[model samples]
Target chain A: MDVALDTLKFIDLTTANIIFLFIVGFIGGLVSGFIGSGGAFVLTPGMMSLGVPGTVAVASNMCHKFPKALVGAIKRFRYGQVDIKLGLVMAASAGVGVQVGIKLQNFILDKWGQSGSNLYVSLSFVAVLVIVGGYVFYDAMTADKSGKPEAVAPLALRLQKIELWPMMTFKTAGVRISMWFTVPVGFATGMLAATIAVGGFIGVPGMIYVIGASGLVASATELVIAFAMGLGGTINWAMHGMVDIRLTVIILAGSLLGVQLGAIGTTIVKESLIKFVMGSIMLIVAVSRALAVPKYLAELGLLDVAPGTVAIMDKASFLIMCGALLMGAVIILGSMYKARKAHARQEQEAFGQA
Target chain B: MAHEMTKKQAVVRMIGFGAASAAVFGGIFLFANPLTEIFSRGGMYAALPIATVFLVSYVHGGFASNLWTALGITAKQPAKTLRPTATKRPEVRATLNA
Candidate 1:
């Protein structure tokens, strides 16, 4: 029963494509591992550039994501970074959010066609990345300058004080905000995942600012949220026959290894460094999406640009996205290298003292 | 203590899990077309992909962890959570939203 999906055609796996997927998957997994969310923003677009349709790319990425999130979550939980209760509450609401977001995406696809859907995805990427990415970056820079840990956001402190009924406390996160406060963040995470195939851009910050989780706990917990988002999303997209299982499995082969390295990163670096990496990548990815927007707009006849211009824009966008991946790899690997060196030197000193 | 898995033990488990992972990937590629068709059938059959992903994560995740441990890239002396998992299943159970 070798059935083909009508909306998505699987491209032949050339040697290059296989190598590319594994490499990209590793980088994506690494990012996802450290921040508890990422890789999808890169992987989805990465798949699309490799000739997969937008929805198929999203679906395939989602298929890989839940499992990745599961692995990352378990790893971080062992370190006491994940709050299962918080992740669960957020994930439940995120499920509802995913349903709503997917409905809107389908509606756009039906009404406006493929280019429109593509344009919608691109615009969403730019908007979310710019707004959320900018905020996260600002917070990271300010925290770094303060030469102290991320000072608890006063908002988080105040929100925790609300004596609402059913106050939920995450012991690892050391936060006691009400369930009322947590669900909306989860729901929004789901919605973002459905639309852009990524929710951690919002989920991590939401946990930090609104729910009072520290950057480490917030990021680790985001893995749980990512898993929930991915599970619900994969189901929704698969039910529509949009998933390219080939892409999913191939990406998994690389990401599985990358994610472990990334999860180790959290232990090696400061919490502020996580935010900085997360923020820097987000802002750069936003630029990448912004570059692609005009191409989609011109395709829809919303702009009168020449076809060559559109092609150029598309190429530039993909290249820039690749650059974003490179930057992420450099920062992550670089940090890991430095941390390992410091750790070794410390061990050597301790031995000498003994 | 770090789950009592020695570096030597981790290396052995890494090889074991690595072989299992390779087998699974080999099976998928060898039977790619049929696997895709069944997994992408759409409907409650979504479970096919979900379950596959979960299985892959467990097997491959184990490999990655062991690989790291064998390399000595573990957490800093791993301060285990002496506290039990404080919050149980969904927080609403613990919540008193009258």
Candidate 2:
């Protein structure tokens, strides 16, 4: 398909655009750092709104994502929240999963063209975010009301009991699950990542509810998967000249800092809150993507929507995406600040006693 | 409680790490346009962008890590690690810091 010339043009950088991207990158980084996967769902769409083509926006955002994930993974590793073996195992399979994902995307793009492709991506986003996000939100609520640690899912417990060959134990994540169980999660994660830039939507939840890892370990371990997927995705995108390096670098400037702060945040808060934040953001982002559905439907000639309505919905969707990022930031920062004060109080009391 | 070292020493380390971070960030932006053009040219050139992200991650990521330590925002994991079950994570019942 001859991608139109206008679709790939690198827009002249305006100061306003740069500042906007930096802010988004920072918030996206924050969420990613704290939960181990996110940011790209907003960043990709954020870039496209600024006159970048859809593919370039996706590619450039991806280019920045791996590095940020790497930084977050390293920080979380220091906290012993990382399962290096589990991460590597997941990553290896996710690599293959990504290729399959990309192939599926290309197939859709070839047959359906851009508008159809957009619809497919949007539908996928809505379906996954609503279903998975709803499950996570319910779990968070249950855990919150009880004010206790989450019980391992019955499903994960059963899976662990299977005497499948190549059963593996992840010391950090503290689970002993068969590779058969782990592979699908990794594969699904990669596929979602390729479909939408938010693989953690599946990756993190899959770890918690399916594999029975603690929220802290599950989230931190996600960085490993993100790093692997991001690296592979970026290379594939860059190979096709899809990456706009300027966007990648500019976003990284803010994201690197955001990611580090986020990683530190994981240490200070209760594990359940991670699920809360993840669940809330996922639901909100689903709405954001859902808002765009009508626009795509109009384009596909499947709906009788007016042009003005489509335009309005598109803008609305973008704003909501920004809102999702903002909400995630607010939750993370608020938790961190509270944790710091309590820690300070404890320290001062200890000093007085001494 | 990131004050493992004296404030003065921490200040020096912060400045040192801060400068290194700035230098690397500056270096990337310095060649930003041309480098982007070359890296995005496609084909085998894909490796360049991947490697570049890796380098930037290490340099910038390390700097950010240090920046946090210098600012005294380190994680307090050892306290929680003593608990046998992860389900026993401390109840952070405090509301948002007003």
Candidate 3:
């Protein structure tokens, strides 16, 4: 694999390219900080569009991801939101999930070739995001309407009641459930992550709905899982000599700054806002991926589509993907601003009363 | 007392780390070719890039964290621990009927 990897060309960093990577990195970091996982899904494709080989883009993006996760995990830890034991527990199972995911990917690539693989990935994104993201969004809206910001899923409550073998309690997440239940959620998160680079989409929601962690805890705890998985993934890619250090560093510059602001944001905003933002981004990205499906279908010779139309759809898909990240950033920042203003007003009222 | 830094101290540390981080990035661009050659060699050389990212992240991540605190964009401290505002029921009176 390393010998084969040697032949793939890495892109030169023109000033324009460097600037683009830095800006995308910041937005991606900001989103990841708020939601627990994002940016890589955009960064990998974003890099490739700039003439970077697919493998190099993935490898370099991965190289930056783990460290960023490490920093985020630490920052959130100070706020007492991270559940280290749970994150490690889920990460252990996610490791197995990644292996299975890779096997499935290889199987698809072998059977259908590149175009078929593309279609499969896109459809998976649509199906999973629509079902899961819709549920999360609906839950957020319901919580808002009822004025109950913290509501556990019925499934989680039932699971917690059951007296099963090896029940573990996560103090920070405030969850006591059978270890067996956690495995499936963790495994699914890993599998999704393997299929799509952003496993946090499934991982965070799985923690909230299935494991019964609050949105803040779930999102924060995800950084630990991300750090573990990203580290392993980076090492594997690096061993193949696929990491482009320059791109890794350039992206790192922006993401580090963005992630810290994101971590602070969790402290100021309502927990449900995390779900609202995560769910919104997931659905938008799903649509963006859906738009690319026709292009892949045409490539597979299943649909007779004009080349011009395919090109237009491709650009639309990429633009929508970028829009999803931007939208998440705006929501997070807007909520933060509102919260800060409210805090200031309360302080003034307290002073007046005193 | 030693554990706490004044705002001025924090700003100074942030500046120092920011400069160091910038220097590291500048060095990477200056020695881009040689570093890439050494890093891309698989096997034992894989550690080169891994170590480089870890080192760079430490300095840069520190700078970013300090910059936020210095700018007063810090996390909200939980108020629950400081307040004892749990409301008590009003006292019941056992008086003769008027």
Please tell me which predicted candidate would have the highest lDDT against the true structure: 3
Better of 2 and 3 by DockQ: 2
Residues A7-53 of candidate 1: C-alpha lDDT, one tens digit per residue: 45666667899898989999989988988877776787778777888
Preferred candidate (DockQ higher): 1 or 3: 1
Chain B TM (all candidates): 0.74, 0.62, 0.71
lDDT of 2 by residue, A1-354 (tens): 122123355876789999989888889899999988878877877788888988899899989998898888877887778888888887887777777888999999999998999999999999999999999988887785433555677788888877687777777776777889999988888888778867889989998888888788888899998888788778788999888877887899899989989988887877788999999999999998999988888888889898888888888888888898799899999999998998899999999999
* Candidate 1 lDDT score at position B14: 96
Model 2 chain A is weakest, by summed lDDT over 10 consecutive residues, at A1-10
Pitting candidate 2 against candidate 3, the one with the higher lDDT is 3
For model 2, the superposed segments whose C-alpha errors exceed 4 Å read: A1-8, A144-149, B1-7, B78-98
> Interface RMSD for each candidate model?
5.0, 6.8, 7.5
In model 3, the Cα lDDT at residue A277 comes to: 93
Ranking of predictions according to TM-score: 3, 2, 1
Q: What is the TM-score of chain B in candidate 2?
A: 0.62
